[model samples]
Target: MKKLVKLIAILALVSLSQISVAGDPVEKKSEMKMDHAMGTMDESKMMEHLKIRQEEMLKMHDLSNKILAETDPNKKQALKDQQLELIKAEHIQMMSMHHPKMMKMDK
Candidate 1:
C-alpha cells in the first residue's frame, strides 16, 4: 500500500511538472496579440523595405554587368569602388531605418 501511494504521488508530480513546462495559456494569448499588432503596424513598412532591397539588387546586377563588360582595369576599379561606397551607404541607411534605437545607442 505504501509503494502504491508513493507511485501515485510521483506520477502526480511528473504530470504537474509537465503542465508547468507547457507554459501559461494567458501569457501565450497575450504574446500572440502583441505579435499580431506588430505585424499589422509593420506591414506597410515591410513592403517598402522589400521594394528598396529589390531596387538595390537590380543596381548591383547592373554594376556587375558593367564590370564584366569593361576592358580597362582602371575604369573597372573605379566602378568597383563606386559599388562598394553605394553598398556602405545603403547599409548605414538600412540600419538607421530599421534599428534607429541601436544607432542612437552607438553614439
Candidate 2:
C-alpha cells in the first residue's frame, strides 16, 4: 500500500510539472510578435550606433596621430593616458546604451 501511494505521488508531481511547463499558445504567439518588433527596432538603432561609432573612431585616429607626432616625452605620455581613458569611457557608454535596463539594474 505504501509503495502504491509513493508511485501515485510521483506521477502527480510529474503531471503537474508538465502542465506548468506547457505555455499557452496565444501568449506564445503574442510574445513572438512583440519580439519581432523589438528586433527590427534594435537593428535600426544598432546601425545608427555603428555609424556614430565610426565617426568617433575617425576623430580619435586623427587625435592619436597628433599625439604620436608630439616631441615632448611627458606631454606625449599624458596625451596617451588621456586617450586611453577616453576610449575606456566611450566603451562603457556604448555598453550601457545598448543594454540600458540591464545596466541600470547593475548599478
Top lDDT prediction, candidate number: 1
Candidate 2 clashing pairs? none
Q: How would you encode candidate 1's per-residue C-alpha lDDT over 1-107 as one tens digit per residue?
A: 65674465345333322111112233422222224445553566556545544555556556766876789999999987876665565555446545779999999
> Residue 18 deviation, candidate 1, in Å?
44
lDDT by candidate, in order shown = 0.52, 0.50
The lDDT, on a scale of 0 to 1, for candidate 1 is 0.52
Question: Distance (Å) between predicted and true CA of 17, model 2?
Answer: 44
| CA shift of 39, model 2, Å | 2.8
RMSD of each: 23.5, 23.7
Q: How does residue 46 of candidate 1 score in lDDT?
A: 56
Task: Report the Cα lDDT for candidate 2.
Answer: 0.50
In angstroms, the error of model 1 at 25 is 45
Off by over 4 Å in 2: 1-37, 41-51
